[model samples]
Target chain A: MTSLYAFVAGPLAWAAFLFFFGGLCYRLLSMLRQVRQSEPFIFSYMSLRYSLRSILHWLIPFFAMGWRRNPILTGVTFIFHISLIAAPVFIVSHVVLWDEAWNLSWWTLPDAVVDVMTLVVVAACLFFALRRVLRPEVRFVSDASDYLLLVLTAAPFVTGFLAYHQWPAGPWMTIAHMVSGELLLALIPFTRLRHMLSGWLTRAYIGSEFGAVRHARDW
Target chain B: MNERHKEPSEIMDDGVEAALSRLTPEKIQAVINSVLKGETGARFKAYMDTCIHCGLCSEACQFFLSRDRDPHYSPVGKVKQTVWPMVKNKGRVDTDFIRRAVRIAHTECNLCKRCVAFCPFGIDIAYLMTVVRRIIHKLGATPLYLQDTAHSHASTMNQMWVKEDEWIDTLQWQEDEARAEIPSLRIPLDKEGAEIMYSVIAPEPKFQAQLIYQAAAIMHVAGVDWTMPSDIGWDNSDMAMFTGDYEIMGRIKRTHFEAATRLRVKKIVMGECGHAFRSVYDTGNRWLGWAQPPVPIVHAIAFYYDLLKTGKLRIARKYSHPVTLHDPCNVVRGGGLHEKARYVVHQLCDNLIEMHPNREHNYCCGAGGGVINCGPPYKNARVAGNRVKAEQLFDAKSRGAHTLIAPCHNCHSGLHDIVHHHGIDLEIKFFSDIIYECMEKPDGSE
Candidate 1:
């Protein structure tokens, strides 16, 4: 990794942690101040159990054979997700940086695999982005924030790839990728990314709660 | 043979078809503007901004799949149909667009809120759809039957005018019938100091009186200390939750919580319905600025789970038939009851067939968020729009599910029509009915 890229990435990493945590708190506090559910179970020990199981639900597919439901969307989402997980793991720069930060190490994949996964992520993100802009079904409701996130997402991949080429890559490109990547990380807690961690409880509770009400068997 | 092609002018359009042409621009813009203003703020902003497309919601939407993959019927298409028009025109769209928006908002899509669960963003497309319906409703563009229900709620507390006497008489009748099943079972009405107060929507009295009977039987067998309020709040479900009439929604929710408070009950046990449960716990309760119900409101699903988990209720006769479940948007997604439902189902039924994408990922029963409240005039359209759900049920039927158990009132009603209109020969059962049937009856009459 270039010294300049590392320097930029270092401050950006701390920036990511601070922004995400601070923003999430600000947003959550605003929500609490506004639409507070007074008797919301402070002690949802049981609900917590349900949520924990759900967080690891998608992990099963990577280790096991298949999914619980619609194969097409599940499969597409799985491939996309797996690609994302791989990009972070295989990047030699990321591996060394994480090792320095946390004193942890796993085997890093070969450079070829790293490049392949990054390319896949780029393609996948493009698929989603194009759908947002071209499809009227999507275009109708989408706002500037939607477009902003799409462009924000592409930044990491674009900068990373350009740096990989290193021909046209300069400090600006590397800096842009590192900065955008950090921004996205920061946005995760405050933005819709909470859906990933929080969706399990919300979705499962909704499913099973209604299931019990209807006297249905499975959620 | 087929004398079908009557000339266009001489066709003599009547019913909802005739009234469609009479729609005016003045009415349309007023309603659209009002709805836009009300549906502002964070929830609206997050919803508008979170789409990256990916079209995963298309598969989850019954309308899109049902309409032969018409992009127009897709969940996203629904937004484009209604909101996009308003947005593009800066809230200055025409009457024809308004008419289409009314159909799309009221009938084409149910505000089941199922799409929100599937979307990675949790964008709450259902809330957006409701906002559109709220606009249409203001314009008097809503279909006749749903409008009538709203009117009923406006004048009478209940959407169905089961009068004061009718309400009490029906409860008494149900009590008497249930007493025959379990001699000591009491359907105590307006009893003070009870730990739990029981409530149901108006449909339970107006149409499905047997639900009251079934619920009473279960309460008796479980030996739960409960009382029913003979007052305005007795009907806990509000159709205004669908109609976007927040004022009426607040009134309905207030009446429900107030009635339970009047009875001095520690908690309220609502009957088997999701949206109603949501109204008290999530939507209307929030609308009225109550953080939570003055009395903790429990849906029948939660009550059943507690009864079973506590070993208070046991089934001597397990239901042996193969059964499938429909996820009601409210209790399932909104309240998070998927596992508890599975727990009860495994305990009660013999062979349970899983719906693909079950739980939070499941498709809506198509009656939720007030889609059913849209009424009979749009019945065929509702059924038509939900062809995908019909096919999903058909697939479950092929997998050998002879019975479908839907826990929520709206889901049951919606699934009933989908099953019938599609001519699927399957029986629909509510969990309460099954719980009542399978539970042990005490040796004497109440």
Candidate 2:
């Protein structure tokens, strides 16, 4: 079990980070090249001011009309995203690993807080899964992969939470958590999760079009 | 769930029906592949990749809201019904699928960017729908009436097929009408080096000649040097843009801009039409490789706002009726003239009662984006689909607003249909219609 954990936490970890960062850079650079070749005029319309304005408005919880209308979904989304980033980065074990690897660290969240954050992420993923199955509008657009992505997103948090509490299958849960988390990171650039990278760009394009050209707010 | 399960009305469009009759699987695959591969680039790919399909855009759409929150009418749902299938199947969709796609893209959706505003990632569902339209256009399957308008633009450089002589005669006729009110008034035509060149959609010459007369009176009263072109470019509206016939759209916009260039006008002041403003200032110009319009084009809302702000046009008396304003999507959301429109309304009217979700967030009139030009075949569905807008109008009327001041021409027509169909008793007027009645004229009229 320890050997398996070592495999996942060592070589698998490097491969996932390599694919995540490298794949994102490739996708972004190729997109830029494609834009330059096809619709180079997009660059002329892009404005930093509008981009920041749009991004800031959307980033704030319930700031956008879309967020305001779907109160339940909005609440879940904010909790999920905040937990998704914070728990994974600020958890003591991960920070200690980072410190041991490169001698770098940031302020860490209390383990108790991160524990609750992890459970919130797990609950949010379940809520999203239920929504995909139940909500007509959401179900119409979702497919098998969407469900699979939800499971993939939740697996790490669920397994991590179980491992942290040292549940019945503690060591196995730790390996499962590391593997699922690494797989999730690696798959992001190739899936709908690519929105993490391109969402801001899309927001910037729309904001510039609305703000600079149309003289309207995008959000 | 039962409400969501309602089937879409299968409106019989002869153009789509006829095109489907001629289309083979290979032809469908060919046109879809060509557009997807050749025309679209990074923006297309990025939008496709970035959408998480959370369905937040559904509420922003009137179709979805009016249809009892039917998922099929949601902006994302519309795209899923149209473009996603083509992309997933690599353009191998059957004729029946194409027919449904035509209906969804052309009839069901308005291409208003309200969904764009509401999306967290700012996914442009309008752009995706237009792609579906482009493929349909290549398949020669655009709705019959809209295609006829595109043909008119191709042949006459105008949507209404108004002949050169007829256009000039319409201006002269309006000039005569305005002259009866103010004897010295002139609808100046073909005047070179004019300070402003005024342009209206072809509908003005075809039917709404009175709007031209009102515009002439306003120009005369304001003491502005404005000329109307008695040429092919007099019409600023482009149905071709909506038809996905970019070639014809580009040609129409080019002629319109060249007319202003030829006249040496400082800017072209467009009549109150939202889609025409979008065609000239946004879509058509971008297609023609000009990021901004070649000649500065001002929408009627902005022009009137400027005239009022500069004290060039004075209100002799404020209109007494409590009125509400319908913000057209293109000019308000597309042009950001919401506040200015309110200022003009307040300047001209005594009591300005605003509709809820006013300004840039207003519901579309179910007309702009060429849906109204789809004509009578789809009118029932179009009117029925925007029940939420009817509710809004009713709510405004209940609040003591007896009149609706819609500045854009398409909004006036669409709102007229909505009010009539929904049994909402409200008088509709253009800002110019009220301005002509309330502004101080040189003849001391008003």
Candidate 3:
């Protein structure tokens, strides 16, 4: 078990990070090249003012028209995303691990807060899963991969929650948590999760188009 | 999946029906594959990837809102029904699928970009719908009436099939009619070096020639130097854009721009039409590889706004009726003329009752994007789809707005249908119509 943990925590973790960053760079560069070749005018209309305006409005909960219309989804989306990012970065254990590995550390969240965040993420994932399975509009667009992506997103948090609490299969859960988290990071650049990066580019393109050319607010 | 199995309305679109009859699987595969592989690039990829399909865009769609929030009419739902499958299957779909896709892309969506404002990622479902339209157009499967309109544009450089002499005759007739009131008023034709080349949709000459008279009178009273083209490029409207015939769209826009360029006019001021403005300023220009219009294009709202703002055209008396404004999606949202439109309205009208979601966020009149051009067969669905717009009109009427000023031609026609169909008692008018009525005419013309 220790050897398996070492394998995942050592080379597997490095491979995951390398894949994540490298794949994102590759995708970004390729998209830029494609756009430059096809629609170079996108660059001309890209305005910093409008891009920031659009991105800032969308980041705020209920500030955007779409977010305001679906309050429940907005609440769930914000919570899930915040917790998904926050718990991983600020958890005491993760910080301690960073400190031990590279002598790197930032301000860590209280254990109780991260625990709550993890639970929120897990719950939000379930909410998303149920929405996909139940809502016809969501269901119509969702395939098995959507549900699988949700499970993948939720798995690390769920197993981490169980492992942190020292539940029935705590050690195994930790291993499962590490593996799932690594897998998710590796898969993100290839899947819809790449939206995390491309969404900003799209928002910028649209914002510039709406602002500079159309002279309208995209948000 | 708890998908509602409602009895789908049988819309007998002979264009789609006949196209489907001629289509073979190999042809479908080839056409879809070529468009997907050749035409689309990064914009397509980014949109397809970034959309998480959370269904947030559903509420932004009037089709969804009007239909009790049915998922099928949702912007993402439309994509799921049409383009997503095409992408997934690599264009291996059957004939029936193409028919349904034509209906969804052509009849269902207004391509208003309202959904873009609502999407968290700003995924352009309108762009995706246009892709489906592009594919359908390539396959020669566009709806019959809309195809006929495209054919007209291809053959005549106009959508209404107006001959050159007929166009000149219509202008002369309108000029003669306007002269009865303002004896000095003349609708100048083919006047080179004119400061402004005034262009209009072919419908103005065909069915709404009186609008041309009103425009002429407004121009005369305002003392603006403008001339109308009595040539092949006189009609500024391009139904081809909606039909996904970008070749014809490019040609039509080129002819319109070249007419203004040939006149050596400083600018082209188009009459009240949204899609035509979009064609000239945004889509048609881009397709023709121009980042900006070759000649400066001014929509009617902007022209009136300028005239009113600059005190060139003074209103003798503000219109004394309670009026509501319907912001056309292309101009208000697509052109950012919302504030200007409101300025023109407030200058002309005494009481301006605003719709619940006014300006950029207003509901589409359900007729833009060539849905209205699909003609009578789809009229019921077109009207049925925009029940929310009817409710808005009703709300405005209940608030004591007796007249509704829709600034775009398509919105004028679409709202006309809605008010008549829904028994909403609000009268419709263009900004030009109201301005022609309320502006100071030199000869006291009514």
Candidate 4:
């Protein structure tokens, strides 16, 4: 039990965090360097104004153009993201673990709040999976990995919830939760999950190019 | 029967068929490899990596919608069908794949940029398709008619193959007709240092000389100092830009700009042609390494908006019939002239009906992006695939839009087909059409 805990909590945790953040930095920097090399003069006079405004506009889910066209998907996406961040970053248990692990801690959400968020995360994952299954357009583009990514995303939260309540297979579920959480983090830079990091830059470039150069309100 | 009403499977014209026959597996692989390896840069890589395959962009595409949501017509699907395999296999794709890729890039997508607006990642799918076009252009697999049009641009400095003497003659002919309305009106030729040089697409001379007369009438009535060049650079339209013939695109743009610079004109005010405006202001200029046009260029929509705003052009009487404006994708969506266009429309027309999705969100007219230049073979599928646009026009008609006003020449041609093929009893007009009828001619000139 001690060996298992040490490997999961120490070495594996270090490897996952390093890969997640290091790979993310590399991806971002490489993309920026390549864009600079291309020398695409983003044709706009008030480019920064549009870029910042668009970033803010899309950051709020309701204010986004996509929200109007796709309310259900937007709502589910918002819930999934908020819960995904909140449970990992703000939950009391996670904060205590973080404090003990690295002398790092912050204000934490109540257990009840964390519980509801986990449930929302789980539900959102299901909704995404169902969309892939049902929508013809979605089905056409999706493959096995898309569905697997959904299950992988949901695994940690599901396991964590079961571990919290001391459900059957409690000890095994705790280890499973830790391993799946680390795996999800490590996979962020390698999968479609990178959109979480790159979405703001994409939205900004689009808004700036269209709004400043074209002088049309794209967002 | 008009080509727009023909069945889709029967519509790949002889030009496209001929181009397809020229393709070989080795040529296809080599061209694709060279393009992917050398031409594509960070933006392409970023877009390829960032697309999540959510299929949200499908909803924004008129082709996809009109095709009953066929995934093949979706923007991402277009990329998947054309470029994905090339990238995955490192350009070892077979000739059949290359043939399908050419059709998908040239005929299927209009490069409207609506999908860019809707994309969660804001991916410029149009730019990706343009890269495909560049590759196909290199392989000599470009459609025969469009390639010929580009060749005409290369050889004659015009897409219609109009002779230098014939171009000047058309201007003289149109000038003679304009004199009946205002005898003092002159289609000034080779007048250097004019404030404006008016340019038009070649089809104006070949098919619609009357539009030249309308423009001449407006210039004379408004009393603006403008000239029409008699030289080879007069045609501002570049089908080569759409065909990915960058060399010819550069030549056409450089010629147009040099003509304006030679005359020392303040700006070039182009006639009602959207894709030509795009060529001068965006793609062609950028290709020539000019971030901006060497001499400023203005689309007719913006030009009309300015004239009305400055009271240089006054309304004698607004057109009384209810009319709807079909926003040309290049002028409205690509150029950001939607509000100015609306301002002109409201000033000259008594009753204006808005299309369902107007302005930047407007669906393409299925004519621009060189699709119409693909000629008769592709026209049927072109119109059929844009059934969403037809429906939008029909809805506008249902609301009592007696005339559908498309300000750009390509939009004028494309929307007219939609109206004709769909059997919608609506007249198609340009902004000039409404303005010519409604603007006050100076009393002495009249």
Candidate 5:
């Protein structure tokens, strides 16, 4: 929350900004341009509905309503997503930064709770990585890019744990955490993780809308 | 209302056969390249630049998980093998590429777009595959059976070439058969200003005409106002979705909508079909450029919900049969009609056996997106691809589901194969059949 902290957060914040702004602008512009150039009919009764829903499906995971068939993976994935998403927002540092910078006054969890969630996130990521590696089908399908992303994801968690523990060295630990966090922000928009924003656009909204409009029988 | 015309047979095989022989390699390549050129040769370029290769999309794809994580079966890999080569070469790929892309795009992938759900970014691999299909169509490299279906659309305005008279005859025949069951069932055709204009894929008239009979009995019992066009729009299924024939797809959608419009109907109701519903609602209609359908288009799930909610239709007896529901990709996940479908199913069947992954997140029946229409050669592979689904069914069966209610025709067909292949010994029925059998009639004869 201090000027020094703000200064340190500058690069990390800018990296998030790039994903939030640059990544978003590029995706939206490209999709719109595709529509513009596509056959005019693509804009028909169902299309406008499709495009709108596709654009609106970010920030929500409505597809988890079903929990019967793919229960193990679905349940595990949902927990992982919740913990991973919550850690960054609910952590004390994130809360304090928001409090100092934006006058936000949401509750900040105690360090112990934050640490537990961070550990939970790391565990879930590891589990997913292990599944991807060990499962014959998953492993066979997984390419170098998958392993790279998993390792990259673990880097921040590893650094965060080291920094939290403040083992052996202090400044080095903090820098490590800072560097990994910055790297994660930079990598997000460039890789398949970019779908975090677009998946909702298609999966939840347009995906459903198209299904609804066409009367494609599902249930 | 009229005299017996002829047997309900496909109206066009000769013309399409003639065109098939003339389909030279040069013609096929020319068509494939034209579509590739349409995007400033940048469509594939953009796609390659866009992928992040995080297997997060694998979670979104049923085929990938169901297939035991075969890398080549992964959605991104699908793009890699089929379209990536063309994109890499900037469109100088040979016929071999065209031949294989056809199989991968049309036969292998179900176009469920479920991967779009789990995608970290919203890359619609379904849409990308569609692009590949378009290229295949242009190259004239489409599979034989699917090509025939596409030709059916181009010629008769319906995929199965059910002539106008045959469509009406099929309706009358269905009504006659249904009347034997209920003594008052009727299939109204070309009835103006009906509350619902019902449409179906040509297969209903061609092979599964009994569905029409069952639907008429359900409508009759419910006292619902519905009509079917005695014209081309009567065939709601669109092969354009399979062949990547946007024009045919669009025309089919417009014809369906316009038929409803012509009748001054309140809404267009589609039967149980996955890709057909997708085509009308998401793909084809969009190709024709409408924000939403001109008229409200309701899936059979929603329509039945309206009937049951209004209390116009009441069950005389619960079906007493134990049943499981197969969530067709288009209606359940894509349309969000899972809860409604459950209500109808549970009301009609005495015992409801829940599939492990019920509703939107359920496995595809392996026949949707015209995968079944790819024909018998790929049948075993299709079943193999859905080995996970078979296991899911067996798991549900262990809980005692003897009958399966599949609302979509494609699901019915696909699930039929899975049930047989898995040796589950389950009987498949449409939701309408149960409604017809159990719902009380106006006369209270039941």
Candidate 6:
């Protein structure tokens, strides 16, 4: 059991991190290289201002322009992503594990906060999955990989929550959670999860291109 | 048969049907491979990798919404059905597949980029669709009417095929009419060092000579130093750009800039044509390797705004009808002139009834992006696909709008169709129409 956890938490985590960061840098640099082939810069001073303003505007999920239109989806996605990001980094149990591994630690979220976040993440993941099943438009576009990605995102949290609560098969659940988390990290660069990096690049390009080239405000 | 499910060849003329028959799978594959491998780059790669197929973009598409929210009409769905298979199979898709791709990419989507605003990642779906168009164009599979228009551009340098003599004659005729209004009014031809060179689409000379006459009066009243080129570059509209004939698009735009450079004009003021403005300012200029227009160009909305704001032209009496404005997709959405356009509208109009979702979020007129120039074969389908816009127009009419002002020429035609086809009673007018009605006329004075 210790060997299983050690394999997932040690070598597997390092490998996943290397793949995630290296693949991300490679993709971004290649995209930047293509921009060099674009027509010469019209050099609008307003482009920089608009791009920065839009970046700040769209950063908050609630503050994005159309959040009110799809409140429930926005709410669930907000809870899912915030908890997904927060519980993995600042939760007390995860911090303790990190400190034990590398003598690295930071301020920890309260146990109650982490527990609620885990439940929210698990519930939100299911909501998203069920939506794909029931919503005809969404269902039509979704393929097998969409469902699989949702499961992969939720598996770590579900297992971690169970293990943290000392549920049945406790040690087994911890190792499973570690493995699932590492799998997600490794999948980031290769899958739609790459939107984390590419989304920023594409969004900024839209704002900058509109502002600088057309001299038009997107908003 | 339901309008949505009708086959492409059912609507195609014999010439286009024969063109489709001539296309071989190998030719299609070669064109698709060349574009995917050469024209596209990492930006394309990023967009493809990042789309989660959430169907949010479907909600933004009028085609999808107007068709009872059919998933097949979604922007992402359009890409998947048309471009994705070609990319995955390395362009080995068959002729039937290419036919359906031409209909969807060319006839259905307006390439308006409205979906870009609604998308979380701001994926420029229009750009992807244009890549599909470039491939299809190279394979010689464009629809006949639009292809004929593109050929006109290639041969005569104008979409309407107006002869060089006919173009000059129309200008002289409009000049004579304007002189009747203000006897000293002149439509200066090839006047070197004029501050502005006025350009118009070919339909002006062929069908709507009165627009030229009105513009001459406006220019006369504004007392602007402007000239209309007597030569080939007077027609600013490029249907070739919409057909993805980049070589022809480049030639049209280059001739325009060269004419302006020869005249040493500070800028070119184009008439109220949305797609033409987009060609000179955005797509065609980029194809010719200019980041912006070589000489600055202003759309009619901006030019009108300038004349009004600077007190060169003033409304003598506001048109006192309950009116609403249709925001042309290319200018309002593409050029970001919504605010300036609204200012001009309110300046000339009284009792303005604002439409729901005005400005950047406004629905497309279903006529820009060469969808109308795809011509009469698909007119019913185009009008049916814009039922959402008809609903919006009805809503505006119920609130007391007697006239719906559309500033772009294509919007004028498209909105006119929606009004006529749907039996909606609102009158369609361009900003130029309303401006000419209300503006103070000169009495042979400065």
Tens-place lDDT per residue, model 1, B1-446, is 12133321122213334455666666566656666665554345445534544454665577776667666777777887777668657677776676667667776677766555445444557777888877766665666666677778777788797789999999888878766666666789999999999999899999899998888878777888889988777888788877777788888888888898899999999888887887888778777766556678788888999999997898878998899887676776667777888888887998999887677667777676676776655556667677778888999999999999899888888899999888998899989878877876665532
Q: Candidate 5 DockQ category?
A: incorrect
Candidate 3 Cα outliers beyond 4 Å, as residue runs = B1-9, B444-446
Per-residue lDDT over A62-129 for candidate 6, one digit per residue giving the tens place of the 0 to 100 score: 56544545668878877888999998899977788788978999999899999999999999989999
B433 Cα displacement, candidate 3 (Å): 1.3
TM-score for all predictions? 0.73, 0.98, 0.98, 0.96, 0.74, 0.96
- In model 5, the fraction of reference contacts reproduced equals 0.19
Among the numbered candidates, top DockQ falls to: 2
Candidate 6 docking category?
Answer: medium
> Which residue pairs in candidate 4 have backbone atoms (N, alpha carbon, C) closer than 3 angstroms, thus clashing?
none
Tell me how each candidate scores on DockQ against the true complex.
0.12, 0.86, 0.77, 0.56, 0.16, 0.52
Q: Which scores higher on DockQ, 1 or 4? A: 4
Q: Chain A alone, TM-score for each of the models?
A: 0.72, 0.97, 0.97, 0.93, 0.77, 0.88
lDDT of 5 by residue, B1-446 (tens): 11122111111223223444566656655565677766432234344555655455665566776666777777887887876667556566555455557667876789876765555345567878988877766655566788789889889988887787888888888888777767766788889989989888899899889888777777777777899888768888887778777788888888888899998999888887767777777667666767666777788888888888889888888888789998888876667788899888877877898987666567788788877887766677778778888888898888998888999888898989999988987889888888877888776445
Report the CA-based lDDT of candidate 2 relative to the real structure: 0.92
Worst 10 residues of 2 chain B by lDDT: B1-10
Model 5's alpha-carbon lDDT is 0.71
Error of 3 at B393 (Å): 0.8
For candidate 6, give the DockQ. 0.52
Residue pairs in collision within model 6? none
In candidate 4 chain A, what residue range of length 10 has the lowest lDDT sum?
Answer: A38-47
- Model 1 lDDT, residue B366, Cα: 69
TM-score of chain A, model 2?
A: 0.97
Candidate 3 clashes between residue pairs 3 or more apart in a chain or in different chains:
none
Q: Which scores better on DockQ, 2 or 5?
A: 2
